[model samples]
Target chain A: MTERYVYMDHSATTAVDRSVLEAMLPYFSEEFGNPNSLHIWGRKARKAVNEAREKVAALVGADASEIIFTGGGSEADNLAIKGAAFARRDKGRHVITTAIEHHAVIDAFHWLEDQGFEVTVLPVDERAMVGISDLESAIRPDTILVSMMYANNEVGTFQPVAEAARICNDRGIIFHVDGVQAAGHIPFNVRDMGIDMLTMSAHKMYGPKGVGGLYIRKGVKIQPIVHGGGQERGLRSGTENTAGIVGFGAAADLASMRFTDGSIEEEVRLRDLLIDSVTSSIEDAYLTGHRTERLPFHASFCIGSLEGESMLLRLDAAGIGASSGSACTSGSLEPSYVLLAMGITHELAHGSLRFSLGKDTTREDIVYVAENLKKIVADLRALSPLWKNRG
Target chain B: MYTEKVMELFMNPKNAGRMEDPDGVGEVGNPRCGDIMKIYIKVKDERIVDISFETFGCASAIASSSMVTEMVKGLTLDEALAISNKDVVNALGGLPPQKIHCSLLAEEGIQAAIEDYRAKRKAGVEAKA
Candidate 1:
């Protein structure tokens, strides 16, 4: 029998929306010209690219000219962190960031350290929230930039980005926020947040893959890491991904409209339902992130004595898609660094599971997941010696 | 990435769970490293009469324990001890490179259980004399 499929891994990537796909069709065939060309075809492509820039910028409350499209969220984060660091090299060589940042930001800082730059990785609280005081103290006279994520991908905890931005602004330091996991799901304005630079991905918000953008607030100096066509106002240099850009624009516009119209309320409701059901029904199941200060569509937990890979496999067999932090899933013996940074034990971290909802998620799907997840966890725990020993 | 056989064994492992008043019990691996296998064996007339296992680990570890238990059932003590991790891996089709250690755990579990049984038998003989 064909089981019903329920997708609950939206934080990893979302399926492209029908409207976004429609917006991108013309750019691939009819208007398939490089924006740099002077011909009429080029003009059409360029207009579409420009219009996309406006739509993406509008979602974040930034000017169209300030948007720099890149290959994906990682590229956007690289440009913001490395670009800002190199641009302000004359002022300082020190950077401040949290230990919970994505590898895109963390690895960039590691590379900087190899080049003789100093980095201070601040620790987070148990809920994965970076303290504002720690951010303040990490700032030094030679500190040039601060890069922190808006929300954690694994635990779904929202950070105090606005407070961090304010702290950076007061210190005359460049601040970059990796908003890849937060942009579409949460309501936040870059201008009001006082963010100098922010990175977001299209694929995380019902748009096409391989297209994302960096929002550079006006007057923020950043050097281009990829030099070729002098595109993205010389910040990210490459030929435009016209079709992907159009889809991103459409996705952003739609997401913004939904946010305004309160359609995300349904997602929030479903997320909470899944969270409540799993935690309440499953023994030793513990929520990972902040109880309330989390993404509207994110629900994460660590079920006791059950390996995440086993749980994920059982869930997949039941026609449900989920993600985990188990060593088996990551192809490494260690658990997730984010969970470790939040002071979770190795055993608990190994059992971590994340279920991210999206626009397409339904109440019935949530109910099904809760029921199947309870059974899956129970089955796995039954075969687990550790679970039996605990009793 | 597991083979179909591995997945099958993992879903419904053979000879799983602890045995009451078993001749010997063996536990191997550590929970901190994310895998632990406990094996129980019942011996009669120097031949293995029954064997069972309980494992806490990923799919590969559980399947490895299950496969090893099935391989050693009704075998002599020496024959059971002769079974290697490679035999368990081969029995389950194959295991991923990273999961090779799980098969090793199964081999160690069987050895430990047999060793425990031998030690107990020797102690009983000494006490009788």
Candidate 2:
């Protein structure tokens, strides 16, 4: 592919690797027996499922039995937040989460709010971090759950999950994390983080889109979010997405293998290349999220006066596949609420672009995107009435 | 590349800032979406003799707001109110579909400012002559 053919929206989703595809293909054909059936074929399927479970467990330092397969990240997140909220509603009515959480956790909390539970949204700093003291002070006698993301999708800021977990654990509040963005890209161990529950989507890694898993620590009680068949230990009731699950396990196994390997360092190097290239080239461009405490695969920034949707469209027209803060929110015409919560103005947020790198990303891709971006920002700013030469 | 005319309006957008404490004021939305345009009118003999605008938005929004001020400068309130968004688009050549809303916002700002003026005029009439 040419320089223009760069794909920078890896945080949104990744292209499935050929190896991951090969690992999952057999399960769709020869190994098609239902894991719940009584026959020998069923037992084989069950054994494969268990092996896959162990792979996922090893990635997160948990027992194989603790992981529950769900349809996707949102469903898993809903099961964790809403299910746990309702199941423990009699015990307490308050749940705490950070302001920068994904919509899955945010919407689930909203649903709980509708059901008469109070939710406190903790604020983030300019670097998009929720302070541990703020979280600790926010906890009350009725606070039942404290859910925060491992890393933000847009800004790439990694929160103090271990610290948040410690606070929640000491206070007896159920701790959970939406680790969809952080699972494959960052080193994650549920036990080390002291998390009671967590959510991850396979698609966030290099796996299929519709498959995800929820980690419910042993003895964590959550009601069934989806009710039908008696599959997934009855927490999730439906025929498993077998092929997708196989692919997910393959992806998890690869991620586990690469955890301490140099892939993450290479990804971080690529991220730095994009960041430095853009910053050194473009004027009045500023980075969002934590400078050091960020995901190796994500970097987001705001260019002066140019709208993110238009920038994304221009970039796509140039053959690069990238998305933006404005394009992501889509209908509201509002700027990124995440950036807004960080005290950046709405206008600046609208002018932002999120450039996320992936497994196949290279230095050449970064240089190409940086060059095109400098040009686009210049052209857009030339037409902006509010744009003035800050340099 | 956008047309030279479109770029002209986008760059030099007339009346592209806010007017402080006019006899009337109008605000359409919170400034998070794109821009918030405020139009200021100075009326003479039931006609908009002098008009200006101050905008807090993107290039398209600022240009449209500026154009709206210029279009209504010497027209009767009735003519000004009849100025449709199509007229603004035609005047600026064309706007992208997303930016068409900016033109509509410009028109809305004009109408809102006029309404505020009329309400004040009504109060003046009820007071004496």
Candidate 3:
């Protein structure tokens, strides 16, 4: 048992890929120029920005002109929700979203509610999936926009977005999908899926932080949340994050290889192994998301009565990096809102754990994590009064 | 966001697990709130002879339970009841502001256990009479 450091918290963030970093390096110093400038230096910078946009657009089957680069995923989400809602205010004052949405989308809706917009939050099933009929019923005649996530961040449950999109399309309401967690991991074409707008974050892939893009279908009405020098076609106005955008492009370029080179299949194999090993080896452990429809790289669970933070600490001691949806881990008094929305009890949700695999994850890594997880869970359960009284 | 001392106690809690045929037992906190501490004590001559705990909580809760049990092991019932959550926090080199509630659970657990012991004693005397 040599010391091993296994990183399984890819949903939180990922290490920047070497090629992505290399692509970004020249832009910071040598290729440095403001895309907003009119000089030769500015043209060179603009070319790089355009190329990055093309690559990002290609990843989602969107046109380069349709992709609006933003600061990050949350900013992109805010812009999509608020921008679309404000742009269509004359047409409607109603909006809808799901209960399992990321805080980025949920909080934006909260702000819209404060602005006197009628907002409907639809609940999910036990699998953390929002029903399409619920979405259809929630849409009012005055509904301006419907924002839903492609895949849930915490539980990895893929929403019925394509169906949801068609429903919104028939109603003449705008549909926005938060694809921050699903974009690079799974293959989705905005055009093919009839998706109007999609959000993506570079950090969720192997790109640098502080750079993400939103794909807005041409003619989809969205005003700029940010107003400044009319950059990003007046949708996002500022000097472009040239280097970070370049890195994001490089990462997006690499993401396509995973689909073509059987890498995603490999990842799915490892992910299933990890899920099976953990669920079978531990007692009273239940998988959190859709068993088959989850992301290829995600496996989440809520074990017995021990708190999540305690399990995380024990796992950390064993040199395994993981994440938990426990209230204690978040320094809050309530467990994960996502888990609760799925009808999980507060006591069981307190034990939530997530392990998001990466491109480099291997079979050995899954075995190591599973072995360590079983021991940690057992140890924490031993000291838990609730575990002692469990039915 | 914990001190090294708190992590130490959390990783290797001094008094942990269920006790058999204990003289007194007290459980505090709620499962819904994600913290519950159960304290068990062995009393001899109105003084705690042995103590253990089974806590379902975060690191701080478990550490507080271990710290309180250790602090009251050799103390009389009155002395144990006098110990405050702030004392437990200080003994663990202070907890984060949000985690201070965990220490309170520990204090309440010990007091409740002591009360249970006294009530049982009175009940025994009345039954004998």
Candidate 4:
């Protein structure tokens, strides 16, 4: 079929890079050996896994031994949250995170709550930014860990992770960062940030899906979330995903090499063009994030009472592939919890759409989307009773 | 995905504006759901001869509202009332399952408009002949 759509939802998952895929083809068949097995084939596989570990470590500026491969970002988050909570239950039974955290982190914290941990959810400003002062205030004698994302997945707001880490370091608290959205797209140094634990996903960084890694600061002492043959230093268990790991490492290597590619600046430029064109042409349309300090590639907006689902469909038909919220929570009937937590009204919240640019996204693509979006929005408003009343 | 019917309505909307001076008007929904439809009707000899609409919402809601206005034009009040969401869906060819609610809301907007017209006419009769 003809390319009927231009994908603008890279915040969800990026297309697998051709280079990363080629690196994986060998591992799945030609070099098929269990890393745990004691053979030359197994040794090669183990060697690849270790190389991947080093590449992953280098991507985040951590020691190779600190990289613990997990199923994906969610599982890594579970490991960091639950493992740390249970392991330190005697020292302290409290955990702190933001209200706008991805469900992976939120649900893990919920599980900790079930196990009798005192969980404090920090609030964000209108831009979905959690305050460091609030983090300080939320800290207590029994707070064992502080978890926050390096950047928000939806609105693309950058969080002050280094500051949060600084505070955590001062208080001797474990600081875990959910960098699944921030990794690759933004520059992150685990050591420089003073993070005890961090999580990342492969697909978000142009690698194959279902593979991810965690950065475990040496001596953090987090118990394994799963039990099996001692793999990932016994933190994440089960037979390793060698092919996915290889792809992840290749992607991480590329991300590190190209982190400063002019593309991010270009994507941000296109993002602003789309936002400016869409909002200026459509009445009552408003951008929904910190105007200047948001993710370089993100554009989120609300257009009056127009339902987001319908607009998304119309925009899709018009050849623009965007998102209503985070792809992870797409079909849920609930409005965006991130926006709601940021104090956006429930009504405007439902009308929201998110457009994020990526490596291949171009100015022409953004312009085409913007022009068609204006038409689609205009037509929808013409049929809206609310628009009529306002007139 | 835009249902065939929804897209058709969006691309070629019917009755998508207010009557020059509508004898009846109806408003429904709010901006929160991203759809608010106001329908205006021109009644001649107790029949809707002209209809127009204004909507503010996402494309589907707007297109659906445009479709609703177009579908209701040149029909009697009772006939317009008989127009069901399924009928609108059928007209649009088909809507994505998630967008079935858009057709539902369109149906409600049409019904609400007719009801508003009836109340106005009834009040007019009580006050006069």
Candidate 5:
């Protein structure tokens, strides 16, 4: 018999919604035309692209003109960080970001550092929160940008983006928020939050992959990382991914509709059920992210003496799709930097597992997952020599 | 990724559990690296009569431990000592490059068990004298 499959790795990538796919279908074949073309077909393609821009902009409260579509979330982040930093080169050589930012933002800052830009990687608290006071202290006359993630991908803890943005605004330092993981799951308004620039991806929010957008608040100058035919306001230059952009627009619209319809609250309820069941039933199983201040659909844990890869393998055998921050899973000898940044021991970090739910995730799915996870963890622990010491 | 043989062995290892009052026990690896294997052996007349292992690691580590135990069962102490990591790797068809360390740990675990058994035997003889 085919095993029952349960996907609990939405944070990694979500399945595209049906409506989003439906909206994208016509753009791929019948309505295929270069948006830059001036013909009727081109006008049709350009109209769809512009409508997508509006839908995406409406999702984040940004003006349609300020939205720059890119290939994916990482690209958006790179453009936001490197573009802004390079554009302001003569003004300052300093940048500030949290250590827990995704590798996209972190690596961009690292590249800037290699190019002689001074970068201050502020440490996070035990709950994976960067200190506002530290941000205030890190700012200097030369600090050109402060790029912090709106939410952590691995742990799901929401960061203080508003406060961070305000601090940067006061210092005249450009603020960029990597909102890829937080965009659809949480309610956000870039204008209301005073965000100078923000990055978000479509695939993380039930939209097609290979499509993402960077929101640059009006008058925020940034150099283009990819130079071509001046697409996306010359900030990102390439033929627009017409189908992907349409799908993204549909996904964004759906996300906004769901937000108003109270579907996210249902997700949160099921998420808490999964979290409570696993943490309470299993010995030495502890939640990794913040207890209360976290994404509604995300739950992570580190079970003592159980390697994440082993647990993932067992979970896979049981037909559950999950992700892990364990060193073994990553094929590296080091565990997740996010957990390590949170001051978790390497041993505990090796035991990390993350489960991010989705809109279609039902109570039955959570119950099945919680029940199987208990057995899987216990069985793996039985095979674990380290587990012998836990008792 | 792992071979079907590795997955099969990992799913139902031949001898997995702690042996009560075993003749000797060997433990290797550490929790920091997310792999630890403890092998217990019961020897009779200088031949291995029984063996079991408790391992904490990815699928390859557990498969290596299970394979090594199956290979050494019923063999004399000298023959068991001759089992190499390469032998364990070959016995399991093959392991990934990074997983070669799992076989090495298995080899070291068996050797450590034999050493512990010899030391215990020598101590027992000394006590009688």
Candidate 6:
């Protein structure tokens, strides 16, 4: 029999779409030209970049001029946090963020702190949802920037984006969001939500890696962190990644189409099916993220007794690809900080598993994974010293 | 990261389970630390006749446990005690630096089990005296 490989690690990264690859192919070879050059070839390349910028902007309902291309999600996050922090330093030296943010945003805040900026890290509830009241109370006259993730990378919990934006707007604080995991999965208009700055990655949404964008709302004052020939309006300097940017544009365009074509709804259905199957069939399994207020295609859990890396290995052997935030997987001594912050015990946190479904996931694949996961969990638990009963 | 031999052992461990009515049992590591290994050994004629392990940890930990048990079975108690963490590591090709601790756990577990068995025999001898 042939091997059955099911990829459910979309949150980590996705397989680039065929259409996106096709769109990017020309720019890599024949159409390859310096976008800054004044020749005809340069003009063609420049036109492609402009069109890509428009497509990326349209994905988030931002104006094309408001979007600045960055190297990747991490770079976009750094640009937003550092750029805004430096620009508004004269106004205030205080910034705010949540405890469940990805390393990109959290480390940026840490760097800002080293540079003399005081940071207020807000706590989240058991479901990993940040409290709006916490945000309201954390805001001070000295607060200049508040960076929070739109959706958690580990648990997929959706933040109180609109409410946080409104609060920041009332306080005249520049609100930045790490939308790396949420951009194309969740539909949101940055302007309507008053989000001053948003970070997005191409690889998370079926685009090629090495390309990302930051949406800076009009009139939002932010300094440029990268210095060079002033490509991407000087916010980012260096030659633009022509082919990668084209791939990102194509991926975003496809995501826009999926949003309208009921494909996203179908993905939600598959996600729910996987969640229900795994949680119901496996004993001592608990869903980690908010059930309703999470990304439609993401499902994470903590299974008791067994560690995450072992589970991932067994699943991979069975041709199911996934990821985990367990200490073993990270090569760290501690389990996932997000789970620990959400009140999960250290023992349970070590058992964390994340399955992020994507456009290619199907019902049969989900069923096969669930069935195999049940057996895997049972088999692993049998070899667990912590497991007392066979069940 | 793990070697091919490590994955082979983890996929199909030589001796993996609990031994009911074992002469000695030893447990090491902690659940909070994300790795715990329990080893059981059956002794006869001063030799380890049977061995089994239950490990709640990453692939390296599981593989280490399996490799240690395979290395010790049918050996004299002294010979089994001489098997070091380095031996377990070498037997499994090699483990990642971060996972070296897992091999140490396997060594400690077997040594603990042997110690337990000796302690039981001493207790019985003292009781008879």
> For this target, which candidate reaches the highest DockQ against the unseen true structure?
3
Evaluation by TM-score, superior candidate among 2 and 3: 3
In the range A1-391, model 6's lDDT, one tens digit per residue, is 2289999999999999999999999998899999999999999999999999999999999999999999999999999999999999999999999999999889999999999999999999999999999999999999999999999999999999999999999889999999999998878899999999999999999999999999999898788888999998889999999999999999999989989989889988998998999888888999998998899999999999989999999999999999999999998999999999999999999999999999988999999999989999988898998887773
DockQ class, candidate 5: high
> What C-alpha lDDT do the candidate models reach, one value each?
0.91, 0.82, 0.93, 0.82, 0.92, 0.94
> Using Cα atoms with residue i matched to residue i, what is each candidate's TM-score against the true structure?
0.98, 0.81, 0.99, 0.91, 0.98, 0.98
Tens-place lDDT per residue, model 2, A272-329, is: 8888888778877999998779999899998766677656756765678776776323
Query: For this target, which candidate reaches the highest lDDT against the unseen true structure?
Result: 6
A188: Cα error in model 1, Å: 0.8
* Clashing pairs in model 1, backbone N/Cα/C closer than 3 A: none
Worst 10 residues of 5 chain A by lDDT: A382-391
Give me candidate 6's interface root-mean-square deviation: 0.6
Tell me which residue pairs clash in candidate 6. Answer: none
For residue A296, what is the lDDT in candidate 3?
A: 89
What DockQ does every candidate get?
0.79, 0.18, 0.92, 0.46, 0.83, 0.92
lDDT of candidate 3 over B8-77, digit per residue (tens): 9998999888899999999899999999999999999989999999999999999999999999999998
The DockQ of predicted model 1 stands at: 0.79
Docking class of 3: high
lDDT of 4 by residue, A181-226 (tens): 8888777788988999999999998998999899999999898979
iRMS of each prediction in angstroms? 1.0, 5.2, 0.6, 4.4, 0.9, 0.6
Q: Which stretches of candidate 6 lie over 4 Å from their true place?
A: none
For residue A365, give model 2's deviation from the true position in Å.
Answer: 0.4
Error of 1 at B16 (Å): 1.6
The residue-level lDDT of candidate 2 at B62 comes to 61
Candidates 2 and 6, the one with greater DockQ: 6
For model 2, how many clashes? 4
* CAPRI-style docking class of model 2 based on DockQ: incorrect
